[model samples]
Target: MGRSKLDVGEIYMAESKIDARIYSEEEYLALDSDLDVKYEYFDGRVIAMAGAARKHVSITGQAVTALNNQLRDTPCEAGSSDLRVQLEGTRNYLYPDVVVWCEESRWADKADNTLLTPLVLIEVLSASTGHRDGSYKLEIYKQISGLMDYLIVSQNRVYIE
Candidate 1:
């Protein structure tokens, strides 16, 4: 399949749905590994992620920093957006802005890039992602047995849910 790469700092307004072709979990993972941009797998479709604005990046960084400080000397560790989280028992994989896990970390495979259990998942909302982050992704994330908190933070203002 033909694909276009977004340049750095280019803002993709919405989830770019891949062509009608359905991809298996393995296929998605294999394709994702070779790409520069990140994509989230939903069922059999892949949704291309949007570029983060300055505020989004700042909020995500601050959240991770704060979590790291509070989790120091503890069992928990914080992860940035580069971490891929797999929703167990499903083919879905998402990249939350920040993830914190208190338990022994679990990876989907030897690759170690895909995290299996995260206690806290944080999403720094942007204008393009606020709706999907709050609704569609929320329902899917709820299936994680070890998830204790799901935070939605607004980059436009001081708000969190």
Candidate 2:
């Protein structure tokens, strides 16, 4: 079957879009090996979102820095957009703008590709990706058993979702 054509903001009658291709774990891992900015996937198809803008990055940095300072000396570690999470076997891996995970001692190395289960997750929203972050990504992160607080920080006037 062919994939449905849906524009970025066009809302489908259905909430979720099922892709025709289902990627294996190997394929997902290989995609991460590339040097360019990689993307996350659900099933087999890539999920598209624009690169972070200046305001977006600023907000992200502020949030991460604050969270990192707060988490210091605790078991939790705060990370900015430097970690990826593999959700189940659905090939859904996302790099949330800011994440805080409490299991720091488990990972042997700092950059050992750990999929930390954040008790706190933050995303500095961009207009192009706000909907996806609020909806699709929101749902995906909710599936994480350890998530306690999820914040979607707006680059526009001070707002958080």
Structural similarity to truth (TM-score) of each candidate? 0.86, 0.77
Deviation from native of the Cα of residue 91 in model 2, angstroms:
2.3
Best by the lDDT measure: 1
Clash pairs, model 1 backbone: none
Q: For residues 61-158, what per-residue lDDT tens digits would candidate 1 score against the true structure?
A: 98999999999999888988888999888878899999998658788889788889899999988877776788667877788887899999987677
Candidate 2 local Cα displacement, residue 25, angstroms? 2.5
User: On residues 28-65, what C-alpha lDDT tens digit does candidate 2 reach at each position?
Assistant: 66766665756666655654334778878888888878
Distance from true location, Cα of 82 in model 2, Å: 1.9
Clashes of 2: 0
- What's the alpha carbon RMSD for model 1? 7.6
Error of 1 at 120 (Å): 0.3
lDDT of all predictions: 0.79, 0.66
lDDT of 2: 0.66
| Residue runs of model 1 more than 4 Å from their true location after superposition | 1-16
